[model samples]
Target: VERRIFTSKMWSLWRYGILLIIMVTPSHQQELSSQVLLDNISRIVDSRLAILDMRMNNIGSQLNDVANQDEKLMVRLSNNLEDKLAELEKKLLYNLEVKLSAIEEKFPNNLEERLSAIEDKLPTNLEEKLSAIEDKLPTNLEEKLSAIEDKLPTNLEEKLSAIEDKLPTNLEEKLSAIEDKLPTNLEEKLSAIEDKLPTNLEEKLSAIEDKLPTNLEENLSAIEDKLPTNLEEKLSAIEDKLPTNLEEKLSAIEDKLPTNLEENLSVIEEKLLSHMEENINQEDRIQGVNEMKMNIESMEENIIAAMNRSSVLLQKAGSTRCPEAEGFFMSSGLSRQCFKFFMDIERSWDSAVSKCLAEGLVLAEPYDPVMVKNYIATKYGMTGWTWINGRGSGSYITWQRSEGHIMSDIPYWYSGQPGSSTSSSHCLLLMTRQYHMKNYPTQAFYANTCTSKYYTLCELLME
Candidate 1:
């Protein structure tokens, strides 16, 4: 009875401890403590301990399997990453070699040869040409001016005399005859006749004299009325017969002859002498030619400096290290972004986007469309329609990557782009040189249906 009581007390304590463990342990793990206490409590405890040990062994083996699987997965992933890195490194090295060779070819080592070639292209007969021009120029401006002045007055007098001779000779003759026929002593003769006359005879003669004076006035008026009425008209007709553009010629001559002729002539002589001196001075001419040559050489040096700066910039930007194995090429201009053309692979807009994403790139978003066009022209020559990153309906377009609103003011679209059919056209397409056919500007944008299949253009962002 004492042994049984002692066993019962131990069992009760063990039950309480198990309950405490159950309360503290997680619900998933609490199922392991399911063995019940019996009258043979020692045997029951041993059996329960064996079952717990076996379950713990099973759990550890399962944990080991999971750890092995995880390690294998990590190892496979690492190997894949390493392979990709090695491939990328090889491609980069190959691309670098190719770029270095191209640079070497484009810009040779011997600058002296280039300088000599440039010198050969320069004009050699500059001094000779200048001398020939100087010889052809007028030297005796003063003598020429004086000669013109001397001939001017004589020509004018001769022309005036010829015009005077053209006037009527009968006019002068008529005037002289009228003067001769007029009575200079008519009043004196009349007075003498009046004195000789008797009183009645004198009165009658006075009346006759008054009547004769009235008759003489009427006769003079009649004679004046019978004279030439068209004298001014005849003179006008003679003036008209002189020349077709006679007045214009005279005005031009007047304009050519300066009002201050002597002062103008002296000024012209000074200017001519100065100009001749400048041209005739062989040393100065040679110096000017040398200066021009030096200027050209300086310009060449500036060009070379600019090229070196550009090369340095290219190195800094990593533009020369484009991923050529992936068919990517560097764009021209300051952006220096890399691009790839998948001409053979035609896909819908969505499919194209997927393809670009898979390649760790995005659809081409050509902010500088002109530079993009030039790059395409230089490398590809010509191409068919291709996909870009623009997507929208109507005038409200946006870049797929940046989601920035497309500015309509930019001249990136073709003549009739973003077409009227907005319902069907919701994606952007690049119009190529082949599509333009030299008619429209190449690489212009055009709206097309999202489902339409076209060549893809992908852009790899710069780090």
Candidate 2:
């Protein structure tokens, strides 16, 4: 049995992490940028506040001098003396505060809120804080703390205690212990580096891929050679394992063993593993993917995901679920809903409709107007048709038109045309006909205009 290492939880985690990371790190300047910018703003506010303090002191002295002056002289020399002085003092203080705030605004840190929260949670007692901190220290840091013991003065214990009292209660002791335990070695320092992902990981990965050794043409040939070589090794293994009725055993597996690969590798897995590295462990991914493909159960799971997103509503005619939106089935990362290949054809409607149903899709629906248009463009580029499910029921044509859309204006046959109920107008033809004296043709052309013969256009429904 082939080994399968990948689990669903691992897949879920990877997908969930990727989506969460997009929200957190978005646009690659990445998460730390806003925090760094916020820090700079706080730094600027500190500098501005320092300058304002000195200027405010100077203003205080000038205001005292103004107050001492006689009211008569003050009023004669200045207007609204009391109010003006108050206003000047208020403006100076307010302006100073605003500049300091400007710096605070630049920082991502809301220092006031964080400090308030920390204060509320801080441990009150010095002994408990100190004891807690000491308890969390690693054994190696015990020696380091002992070295600093004498440096801490007995009389200064209260000051150290005060600082500890202000420390956040939850991690205060642990953090102090961590600080004491920090390695003195230059190579080791407290850092969040392990938590940080490289900003250039993707680019670096791409760069590595570019640098990887791959032969221009010879590598493909080597890979092809390796395929049969692997087959030989597996055959040898079977030979070694078979019981001693060698002749009968060899005959039983001889024709079947080589073909087992097809059973082991699903078409999807085969497609996925077609891309593998040329290095020593390249077969690891190849085998894993190959095994995943082999599991029809997984493919069915993927198909369900495809079905969920499929627009082809399975109306158990009376069933109560309004169909899910059509575009979703093919949208999943692992599922591909449809593939179209245009065969060179010269056939009638009956044959075409049968051909489509055989492929497990209906005549192309006018849904996915854009995909239909492109498909038609590539297939005939100029034209295509879809069969309508209008027989026995009213005319509800859902053919793949040029743009996966039915033109808003239904074709009004020339005054005398489309009057025939039977054979003459049975077939729908994209052939040229005069409309209002101008030549008009449908995108999909059929040789005959007899409507009874069923023609097929691309229509998609769920598997």
Candidate 3:
């Protein structure tokens, strides 16, 4: 192999080198002078160019032959390649087609032949037989029947022909007569349904079972429950013809019950409401509400008066009040509670209170009964209330305005008891209701009620 390669390389070099030498040796030299030799070399170069063009044409022809031979390889590789091509085609089909088969398929052979093949697969007997039945249907019914006929299973044509022979003549007139005579009496309708009891009802019901809604069986079962003792055997005989489960049949029976029951129930509710309104006096209820409000306000004023006296005593106690902050008010405040910000966060309740004190608010303490009532009203609006430790008598819980120390004074426990749940919802909160404590807003999951041990709001004479 080594010798063969070396010999081949040398031979190629020799062949090319000789051709080059021949081209360089003047091909058209006439007089052996400098100018003539140059002219001869130019002629030789032209000859070499012609040969190069011929060689290139031969290489191109060879390449075309090689490409033709590769066509066989394409077929062998087609297993994987065809699958990839089909995948691409399916994607394209999905993009373009509302129904893919219509886009993906190609018609083969004659259109009439294809149509004939398809028809051959269908139930020949039924299609031909349906003509007589179709003649009996209403105009609109005929059209709908034709549309449905196209979709049924292939054997339908034969079965339909057999059924056609069994049907009564004058079908259209009979249907119209039946529609016009729809039962004026309940007993008549029930009797009609029983009289028409088909001999092949079991087979018919079995065929229809898959199409019936689940409620049908349930309705039938319920009818069984209400059936009179005298009619038990008769009803059971009919029930045995049903195809569905007991529950579904009972449901179907109830659904078919007369509409009179619904109308009667509506009439009863309206009558009851009319009677209730006639028995009650509207004026008495209004008078009771106004009296309760007047009493509460009077009690509230008395408590406020006492708080003023306590404020005077605190002044006399010589506790130096710091200069009032920007929003500070020594007197009663506007009704709305405002939000405040504290820069520092602390771990413990006592530390939080100290932080609030530094910021010029007190752990809120209510001074008077009105204050207690107001606080009660406020906490109800909030999720819960916790007693922030502060100074106050039963009359009022007052926030020491200078720094957070004084707390609101209010004692409120639900009339019955405290309820701690599975997670030990131990602490009590006074969730302030929207209309004082009367309207309770349901708490959201994340609304943590204030606890005594938790960080709480400080009432400030705000800056």
Worst 10 residues of 2 by lDDT: 433-442
Question: TM-scores for all candidates?
Answer: 0.31, 0.20, 0.21
Among these predictions, the greatest TM-score belongs to 1
Candidate 1 backbone overlaps, count: 0
Stretch of 10 with least lDDT, candidate 1? 284-293
Tell me how far the alpha carbon of residue 128 in candidate 1 is from the true structure, in angstroms, after superposition: 32
Q: If both were scored by lDDT, which would come out higher, candidate 2 or candidate 3?
A: 3
The better-scoring model by TM-score among 1 and 2 is: 1
Steric clash pairs (candidate 1) = none
Error of 2 at 209 (Å): 11
Candidate 2 — which residues are off by over 4 angstroms? Answer: 1-75, 79-82, 88-333, 338-340, 346-360, 363-460
Off by over 4 Å in 1: 1-316, 381-383, 420-425, 435-437
User: What is the lDDT of every predicted structure here?
Assistant: 0.61, 0.41, 0.42
Q: Give one digit per residue, the lDDT tens place, for model 2 in 396-419.
A: 222333222121122222223333
> Tens digits of per-residue lDDT for model 1 on 28-70?
7776643432334567656666666777788889999999999
For this target, which candidate reaches the highest lDDT against the unseen true structure?
A: 1
TM-score of 2: 0.20
